[model samples]
Every structure is written in structure tokens, then in C-alpha cells.
Target chain A: MNPAFENITSLRAKLAARDITPTEVIEALRARCTQVEPSVSAFNHLDWDTALREAATADASLPLGGVPIAIKDVIAVKGQPCTCSSKILKGHTAVYDAGVIERLRSLGAVPVGRCNMDEFAMGSSTENSADGPTRNPWDTSRIPGGSSGGSAACVAAHEAIASLGSDTGGSIRQPAALCGCVGLKPTYGRVSRYGLVAFASSLDQIGPFTKTVRDAATLLGAISGRDPRDCTSLDQPVPDYTASLEQGVKGLRIGVPKEYFIEGMDKDVEQTTRQALDQLAKLGAELVDISLPHTNYALSSYYIIAPAEASANLARFDGVRYGARVPDGKDVLDVYSRTRALGFGNEVKRRIILGTYVLSSGYYDAYYLRAQKVRTLIRKDFEEAWKKCDIIATPTTPTPAFKLGEKTGDPIQMYLSDVFTIAVNMAGLCGLSLPCGFVQRDSTDLPLGLQFIGKAFDEATLLRASHAYEQSTEWHTRRPVL
Target chain B: MNVEYVAKLARIDLSAQEIETYQNQLGSVLEHMDAIASLNLDGIEPTAHASPVFNVLRKDEIKPSLPVEDALSNAPKKANDLILMPKIVE
Candidate 1:
């Protein structure tokens, strides 16, 4: 049987029934990756030998037994090449597994490869990747949304059964939306970030990109819970996320924020999102009109706080430590300057400089400090909305995937791609983006996603609502002809 | 915007042309950031951490760490088990 496009639940059942061995699944996936990697450019490090070897001995009793999940290069898997798709980390191999990797292993999930991403998870398009862009499987000329582009693409193209991705301001969800898959960014602190190469520490959370909402829930259940290594990891019990997958969203209040449907939103996105909401309403959900008043400030505030934190987090990548280094320097300072200049891409350098300037002595109050305060206001906006609604709904992106180089030259236009999704991260709420409809352009069907934001630790409700919508609609089943 | 000074602080070297380009780009970014000032945030506290859990303390017991081989494995320049760096204060 072709393992491609099958969800983990079905794969596990097949493994248990002895219809498919773990080695057969790994071999089939490896063959699929070989077929698609040239066009999709999905992986940086594909360890087929180790994956097949591990699959041979995998225990079927474990939850994710023998299932191969592609990992975002930003998240470390021990002994694998963890490049984050940057020249700086050219030959760097992770010495230890990320907290999520450890959890995946305990559940018997085999990591098949390190998927490409935006350099240091910085940019909306995978065009920022030093390893080259991951093309959208739906249309090879268009980009797979990023920084988790490879993670989303591999899942959409069926190179891997599921994939893990990091979302710092819509990295996972945006890519999933563009690639036509299910992506969930858990509540901040819901997943441990101990081994994730730090991008913007507070906003970055690791999540899964999967074929179905049930697979997303299953993967989230396995990879979540507290880890002592990550200080921000919530000290709470991990729920069985799949337990409520069948519970339809009856008596659920889904907020339709007027601010999200703004003047410049794409007509197709608006129409499709409205249609999805109507479908949800038909599924017994009450669509309440609500307003997240501080929504406009999210993008601006995110640009400030994320860069300020990134500047601090990225300071460790000097010439002295791990990864690539420049030897042509007279002094230590020269080495640092030369190495960083040669190492980082233009976008990363721009962000680092912007971050430094904002956190500088004179501009602290005007930019960084004030931006943090605006962050508070944004959170409060969501807090107020929760009183009247159980879930918040919006278009996952303002539009579907654009051409490869469409927004490359304009930073602001690229930043606007995440306008609908960034507020959830700033408010530290859990969000899920699932395919709802396809917008046909030039005879090519590009997928549009519907996003749902839920209260802290209320991912179960998100799963139930999205699962209901997913089951009711046929959008998730429409695979891109790769 | 003093792009050179910020680049110096970031320890990244930039050409004169790049500096001029950054000045214009970052100036606009700062202009975008100016939107935050319009909010009447008098007594609002900044959110440093999204989760309430903080100042977590763990047991003082020693735990096994990555071995010397693994620790120095990724170093660009290394001698046996130690990472090598350029001369300083000489």
C-alpha cells in the first residue's frame, strides 16, 4: 500500500494489523521523498539508512510506532544536521535531541529528515533559505509559505506522513495554509523549546503539520507537556488531544472578528472564509460578532519585540563557538564581524541590526519598551473577546500562496502575509490553520485556510471545532497533484 | 538611523552601499514602529513571558551532560576537547 498521504492513525492501524511493516513504510516514504525532493526541495538532510534501520526494530505498541515525521531544520534531532537553512550553521550537527524529539522517540516516531526553512526561521517565504526555496507542490512556480515551508510542503506532497514545524509569528500556520494541510501552534509554553534554535524565544512554539485535524491532535498529544529544560514549558498535564476529535462543535461560540476582515483582504479569501464560517454555523456553532480592538498594533509590536529578543538570542553565533567561522581576521572582534557578515543572509542581518537599534540605550522607550506595552494591550484584546466567544475565526492568510519572487523585494509586503495570524502569537493563544477551500487562479487551484484561535490550554475545543469543520467540508481531501 | 553603529553593535560588517540601503529600510521600519506610541498605555505592564510559570528552580543534583567529544564536535576550530578562539588582550 502507498503510505503517501495517509495519516498517522491509519498508518499505525496498518502496522498493528501486520498489513505493513515499519521498514516497508519507511522504504516507501524514502522512495516518495526521492521522487519529489528534486522539485519540492523539501529536506536538507534525509537519513534514509538510519530511518530504515530504526523502522526495522520499532515497537508497534507505542503511540506513533514506526511513523516517520519530517522535522523542521530549526528543531534539533540528535546526530542529525540541524542547519536552520543558514550558511552559518553549515556543518553543525545537533549533539542532543530537542525536547519534542525525545517525546517523539518515546512514542516510537522516527524522524526521517531535517526539512528546510527560512534562515533562522526569519521571513515569510522560503526564498530566504540558503539551501534554496521549497516550491509549493500545488504549483511548482509558486512558493510554499515559510519559515516552515519545507515542513508544510513535505506533508502536502506526501513525502512524510507528518512533520514538525516551529511557529514564531505564523511560521507553521502560514506555510500550512499555503501548502494545504493542517497546522497547529499550541499555546505558548504548551510545547517545550529547549532544543529549538532560538529565533524569537517567547513567540516561537513547535507544532505539527499533518494531513488531517486528527493527525494534528494525535501529534500534539505526543509532543506536549512540561520539560524542566525549558523554563517556559507549562507545568500542566498533557491531555489526550485525540480524545475529543469526534465531539462535534455544538453550543460553541466562534467569534468573527470584524477587524480581521479589513479593506485589503483578498476577495477569494474573504468569500471562502465566510463560506467556511457558514458551514461551521450549520454544524451547530454560534458565530458571534466580536472585535479584537488592538489587532492593528500586532504587526508593528511583533516586529519590535521579536527582533529585540532575536538580537539577544542570536548573540551566541559568533566565530568562536559551533558552526561555520571565518579564519581571515587579525583579532577576535574582527573574526566576529567577518564571520557574521559572511554567515547571515540579508534578512537576518537586517533584523539583527533593527533589533539592536530598538534595544539601544536611546531608543528603548520609544520602540522596544512601548512595543511590549502594546503587546499587553493586544493580549487584553483577546482576553476581552473570550468573554463573548469561545473561539476566534479568521482567514489564515490574507491571500493564498503567491509566486516565488512576488514579495521578495518588499519586506513590508512580506510581513503583511502574517497579518491575520500574528495577533494570536502576541496574545500567546493557541491557534490552528486548516484547509477550508481552494481559490482557482489560472486554472491552478491554490488552497485557502481558515484559522481558529482558542483560549490558553483549550486546544481540545479547537480540535473539536476544526475537526467538525474538516469532516463536514471536503477541502482537506483535495490533494495537490504533484 | 546610524546603521553603521547598529551594525557595529551587532558585530556584523556592512559595506557603505548596504549601510545606505539599511538606513532607508530601517528608517521606515522605525516609522512603522511609531504606531505603538499612539496607544494610551499609561499604567499597562509589559508582558515579558506569556506563561505565568517563571523563576523555576530544579534540584541541585548533578546530571550527566554531553560528553567532551560531542560538546566539541561542532566547533569550527578545536584542540582535542577545547574550542579554539583568536587571541584576546595580547
Candidate 2:
């Protein structure tokens, strides 16, 4: 069997049985990537030679031993370029391993390639990348939902067994929904953000894009835990996420929020999500009708807070320390301005300016501060809803993947694409998206996603419920014929 | 929304055309954000971070730091062991 298309669980078993060596798996992935990469464009960079060398000496005894995992460009992997899909950091190689890379490396996982993303993780669509957009494998004409678009698309196209993606505002889950794969964003502090290029500091969490919920659980366990380097990382004990996967969702209360099924949502997406909920109810899980009243303000507040934090975090890119620098600057200020202007993409520049405006002298209270307080209300909504249910369910996106260049012309239209997924980030809750069913569009079958939001650090229950739902359906088994 | 002034504060140069485009786009986004202005947030404590951890202090023990060469490896301009920057004193 070709290890390229197999899930991490089966690959781990195959590696242990010595049916295939790590080198063979890498070779299979290389062949697959060579075939599909030109059309999919999932990676910014791929170092097959390095991956092969690492695979040659891989110890197959460890948990993830010899498995190749694709990494998003935002996370630092020593000797690999950490571009974040922006021109500013072009040619800048990471001198140290990110916390996640260190953890994955310890388990003998070979980090293979740098997956593409929105420049500085600013946009919902990978169209914001300077490296070019990653196309959805399901329908080549449509976009792969983004920031983590490449990570999701690569897994769906069988370019890699599993890959890592960071979710700031649905970057992981939304794209996974569009690309028809399993994506999870752990509770805010559950994973270390030491090496993730900060998009929105308080909202960012690195997670996985996989073919199966089991693979997501395994990947999440390996990368979680407190690190001294990232002060914000929770000091909680890391639980074995896969341990509870088979527990099923019997008698568990799955909250279905009324606020999510808003007007103007696609009929097919709503129907698919409802059908999935019915399947969960049929499987002995209790479905609770719930209300997260402040949901309407989530997008507005996220735009304010995220940009405000981003404007401050991105100040490090000023031409002096690293990355590109324009040569003919008459003064320091000139150098900073010219370098940044030339380096950043349009979307990145837009956010930076917007961020700067909200945090500017007179506007801070009206915009930034008010948005933070609104964030409290959003979090409280989740806090209250959790009292009635074990987890919450919603449609990951209002619609399936749109055609490329569909929303690029209008930023608000692009931002609206993430309306369903952003509230989870605002509340700092863990959320996952898995394929529920498919909707036929233009003579092609496009997949729909069902999102599950869990309490803070309660990834175990989230995984259990998701796995139970995933197994009862065959959506996870469908693959894009690239 | 003074797009030019905001761009100046952001230290990124925007062309006349880009500024006009951003002015319209950001104007609409900020208008959308106006939904939060009328909220009654009395006694609501702002959540700066989702994780409740604060003032995380590590032991002030000596640890191996990144070597100067390694640290300056990605610098745009560098001397023997230092990153060269434009003169701040004019």
C-alpha cells in the first residue's frame, strides 16, 4: 500500500510491523507531491533531500516514528525558511526549532515541507499569500479556505499523511472544512506558541490537519504541554488525547446554537450540518437547543482586537534585524517604511494600518478597549452555554469553498467567510471541523463540514464526540481524485 | 479614517491609489465594527487574554543563549558580531 495516502495511525502500525521503512514513506510522499503539487500548490518550499536524510536514520519505535508531517510556514523549524508566505521574510531561515517542532522531533516525526499561508496569517483565503494561492483539491477552480489553506489542501490531496496549521480565526478549521479534512484548534494556551509567527497573540493556537479524527488526536497529544519559553502556555498536564477517542458520544449533550444558523447561509450547508446533528442524536447523544446571544458581535470585535494586537506584534519586521531591506534609504525611518511597504502584501498592509488606527491615541478607547470588553461578553456566552452542554455544534462555514478570486475583490465579503469559525477563537475555546457530507455543485461534489466547539482544554471530549460522529459516517473516507 | 496618517503611523508607505483603496475598504470595515459602539459594557472586565496566567516568571538562572553569529544570521546588514543599523543620532 502507498503510505502517502494512508492515515498516520495505519502508517504508525505499518512502520512498527516493518512492512515499510521511513525512507519508503518519504519516497512515496515525494512521488505524490511531484504529481499533485503543481496543481495544488500547497507548499512554499519542500526539501526532499533533507527529509530523506532524516528518514534514513528515523527510529521507528517511537509513537510517531518515521512519519512525515507537513508544517505551516509560520512555525519555525531550524534550517527551514519560516516565511509565513510573505515577501518580507523571504530567504530568512529559522536558526532554532519552534516548540512544536522540538516536540514532534522528539517523537521521531520528520518535518517535511513549509506549507503556504496568508501573509502574516491575516486573511481567511490563502489568496493573500505572496507565494500564490493554494487551490482546493476538491474543485480546482475553487479556493481552499485559508491562512492554513495549504495545510488542509496538502492533506486532502494526499501530499502528506498529516500536517500542522495554526488557527487565529478559523484558519485551520475553515480551510479544513473547505478542503474536506479533519482540522482542530486546541484551546488557546493548550499548545505553545513560542515559534508561531503571531497573528493575533491571544487567539492563535497551532493545531493539525489530518485525514482522520484519530490522527488529529494523536498529533494534538504529541505537540501539547507547557513550555518555559512560551509564558502563556497553560501549566496543565497534557492528556493522552487518543485515550478517549473510542469512548463515543452516548448520553453527551451536544449544544446546537440557534445563532449559527443565520439568514443568508447556504441551504445545502445548513441541511448537511443539521443532518450530521441528527446522526449524532440517533447515536444516543442528547442534542440541546442553545443560544449564544452575543454571537453577532464576535466578528466585529475580532476585527478590532486581532488587528490591534497584530499591529503591535508585527512591529518587529522593521528592516533592522532580519529579513529584507531596501538599499537606498536616506534615514532609519525611510528604511523602515520602504522595506515594510515593499515586503508586505496588500492584505497584510491593510490589517497593519487598521490595527494601528484602532490603537491610535484618541481611538483606543472607542475601538480597541470596547472590543476587548465585548470579547468578555462573547467568552461569557460560551461559559454560560457550556453549563447546558458538553460541546457545541455548528456549520464550519456558511457555504462550501467558493471560486478562486470570488471574495478577493471585497475584504468584508472575504471576512464574512469566517463568520462561523471566528467566535470560537474570540472565546479561546477548542474547536474541530470534520467532513459531514457533500453538496453537489456544478456537476462536482463539494464537501460540507460540521464544527464542534469544546470547553477550554477539553480536547478529549471534543475528539471523542468527533470520532464517534466521523465513524458513523463515511465522509472521512472520501478523497479528492487529483 | 485618515488612511494616509494611519499608514504613516504604521510606517508602511502606501501609494496614492493604494491609500484610496484602503480608505474605502477600511471605512466599510470600521462601519461594520460600529456595532460594538452601542454595547453597554458596564462592569464588564476586559479579557486581554483567554488564559488566566499572569506575570509568568522563569528562574533567573544562567542558560546558554543563541550565539551572536547565529542570532545575527538573518540580519539584513551586519558587522563582525553586530547588526549594523542606520544612525539614529542626526
Candidate 3:
């Protein structure tokens, strides 16, 4: 195996056998970081000295000891600048570690640095990133999809063994799909959201971006379970995600939602996904065609509801609190106005205004309330479909990533990219995206992601299906020729 | 809504460039949202949060506070461990 291409499982075994020291692994990672990071733009922050120190102290017996992991900038890691890649939050340092960060540290997983992302996790492509765009490691001109673009890129480029990423709509999984990595978004409350900066509070959940499905689960096993600080977190027992990986899908029922194969989907993506389904059928899992009829309005309903919630949640970022504060002028309003005016990016401002408009007096019931009702109908559609199958599978993204500046000028076109994934969030379900295949498009090299969504709190089913798919294919093993 | 109507209602004086962009973007976005407006959601209880969380019970205990200096340490301009802001009022 190439020294730079070790997955979390292989890295753990090497650490146990003393074939690689924590210091050497960090050196290899730092070396890889130096080589590919400039073109990749995978990180917003780097602190090698701190990572080395932590790695040096990793317990010799822990499962993930000494594996360097990257954290999305939206997440807090005590004493680091958790900017969420926005100029407004520039120079703001966190006073505390996020819950997931603490858990990774407790397991001897060294947090290498903060990865880049869309400002406030607002955009689909990291092009909206204030830190500048995170390019596809496979093709520097194309996008590494956002809001967890940096995390996916870093994991894909082998900068870190795995990384932490937040998904509100398709943020984590979308980027993972584009970058050819595995990303999982747990059920709404499966992972703690206490320390995560809220984008759309109701839709946001944090999970992993890894090179393999099992690693995504292993990393999840470490950070999941109930936390007293976040009341919204499900108070359910945490299961060993890796232990259930071998639970064969011999008798599993997989539903391929026909609605996802809508018109205008890229021909290559459609063909590749169809090929994957045939393989799954040969693996003994029955494939059934299903429908998500309310899907047509999913994007419309989610846009209103997510932005409305985001508008309310982000209200706490005023200068009175710990975020970037504008210089105080005569009154409080001046401080707030100037701070927000200078701090927020155009996309964030756009969403905030859109959210504010939809939630205003006369528009409240007409826009926000109706979107809520549609959200229910969308969820009900899923509940009805689940009774016929064990899991739903589709292409994680409708198209392979476009050029960085391709859709930046059009926000609606950008929102359309989340079409296949956002409804899953609106329905409060769990989903995982893994690299099922790759395609050559637009003379640029980027991978299309195959997304498998499980019923609410049915992460095991998604993982089992994805693992079975991966175990039988070599797509997960391909690497960028950096 | 007219450009000025929204600008005043939102409490921000948007630049001419911003107004042009908003006029186009907001108009289209809202038009797309029109689909939901026509849905008959009669007698539907609006769902607030996707997850379940009950009345939170917290121990009403106080702990030592971060020194005033530490709390205000990141403030760009401060006085006596307090965050300093620009003067208020128009």
C-alpha cells in the first residue's frame, strides 16, 4: 500500500504493530498536506506542532490512536479560530472544544487542523467560501462541493485519516460524493449539535467524511450517543457501527426511488448508478422501484423552512455575544448593523433576508406555515415507502461537480444541486454517500457519489448496504494522482 | 414588494447593486415558493422542530465565572474589562 493511502482501519493496525509511529504518520500527513494542499485548498487552518504533541500522547491501546483527523471550520476545537470560513467571523477564537472534538481527543485521535467550508455552511459549492474556493483534488478547476467541501477534500487527498463534517441539507454527503469519499449524516438528533454553529438548527446534524464506509462508522461510534448538553439529541443507545458491518444484506430490501431518475440528470451519472443497482441485485438484495411523489416540492419547501429557521438561529451572532462584533457606534443598532454588514457574505445575507421576508407578519402563515405542512407530506411519503423496503438508494448528487465559478452567479441553480439530498433532511432521516463509480465529464475528472438513505435512526441499514457495495468493488480504493 | 418597501421594512439601506440583485433573486425565489402557498393545509398544525426535546431541567447552580478580562479578551476595543462599542443614536 502507498504510505499516504492508508485508511483508518489499516492505519490503526500499523500503529499497533509499530510499523508506523504517530510522529511518522503526522510527518507523512504533513508532507502530503504540503504537496497537495495548495491546489486542494482543503484546510483553512493548520497547526502541526499541536497535532504532533497530541499524537505523541495517544494511548497505545485505543482503537483510533494517533490518527490525524481534520475538523470542519464550522465546528469548535478549543483555542482555534473556528471561522466557518467567513470574513465576519475572522480572528474569532473558540474558548471551548465542541463535544465531538472532545470525544475524538479522548480516543487519541489527533485533530490536525480546521478544514475550509462555505461561509456559515450556507452554500452548496464551497465557491461561496470566504476563504476562497476549495478545488476538487481530482481536478483543480471543478468544485469540491460544500459546506463540508474542505473536509471531503482533505480525506480524499489523504491529508487526514478521516474528518468531521456537518450536514444541513446535502452539505457533507454532497461534497463527499463530488470528492469520491464516504460521508454520513446521522439522523437529526443522533449526533450532538451543542457546539456546532447553527446554520439551519432543525436540519443540521454532524457526522464523518472518511475514505471508507467502516471508518465513517468507526469515527461515528466515537462521537455519537446522547449528550446532556443537547436536549434535541436522541437519548438512544449507541451501537458499535463497525460490528454490524458484516451483517450481510442477503435478505435486505433496497428501494430505488424512481423520482430521482428525473429528466435532466446527467446521462453518465444515470448510466453509472443503473450499473451499480444491477450489481446490488446480484448481491442478493431485492431491488424495488418506489416513489417519493411529494419530491417535486421538497426543494421548494426545504428552502423556505431551512432559511426561516436559519434566520432565527443566526440571530444570536450579534456583537453582544462571543462572535465577531462590529465597533460600537452611538447605539446598539449601529454596532449590530455595521458588524453584520461587514461580517456576513452575500449568500448568507441573501438567505437571512429571504428567511426574514418569508417569516414576516402577513407572509408567515402563507410561506413558512405552508412549507411546514409540505414538510409533513414529504415525510409521510417516506414513511409509506419504507414499509416496502429496508433502504432507499440513489445517486448522491444529480450531476458531477461543475467548475468553481460555474454556478456562483446564480443562487437558484446552486440550490437545485441539493435536490436529491435535501428532502432526506426535511424528513429527518439518516443517509450515507459513498463512491460507487467515477465518470469523465466536461474534460475534468470528478467522481459522482451514490447515496443510500435509511429510515430514521436506521443508520445500520445504510451502512450495511454501502459496505456490501464497497466490499465487492474497488471504487473506494481509487486515489487521486496528486 | 417595491424595492424601497422591502429596504425600509428590513431596516437596511441596500446599495443600488444589492437592490438589483435582490429584485431578481427574491422575485424568483418567492415565485418558486408559490407552489406551497396553493396547498390546502387547512387544520394542519405547523411543525416546529424535527427532533424531540422536552422542557429542559437544569440544576440552578452557579459556578466561578471567567475573569472579566478573559471574557472580554477578544474584544477589539474594551474598557475596564467591558466591551466598548460606538456611541448609540442617530
Candidate 2 segments whose C-alpha is farther than 4 A from its true place:
none
The lDDT-based order of candidates, best leading, equals: 2, 1, 3
A1-482 per-residue lDDT for model 2 (tens digits):
77898999999999999999999999999999999999999999999999999999999999999999999999999999999998999999999999999999999999999999889888887999989999999999999999899999999999999999999899999999999999999999899998889988999999999999999999999999998999888888888889889998889999999999877779999889989999999998999999999999999999999999999999999989999999888889999999999999999899999999999999999999999999999999998998999999999998899999989989999999999999999989999999999999898999889999999999999999999999999999998988
State, as a TM-score between 0 and 1, how close model 2 is to the true structure.
Answer: 0.99
Worst 10 residues of 3 chain B by lDDT: B4-13
List iRMS for all predictions: 0.9, 0.8, 2.5
Per-candidate interface DockQ score: 0.85, 0.88, 0.49
- In the predicted model 3, the residue pairs found to clash are A88-A343, A328-B85, A328-B86, A329-B86, A329-B87, A330-B86, A330-B87, A330-B88, A331-B87, A331-B88
Best by lDDT: 2
How far in Å is the alpha carbon of A470 misplaced in model 2?
0.6
- For each of the candidates, give the backbone clash count: 0, 0, 10
Worst 10 residues of 2 chain A by lDDT: A261-270
What TM-score does prediction 1 earn?
0.99
Residue A135 error for model 2, in Å? 0.4
RMSD of 2: 0.8
- When 2 and 3 are scored with TM-score, the better candidate is 2
**Winner of 1 and 3 under lDDT:** 1
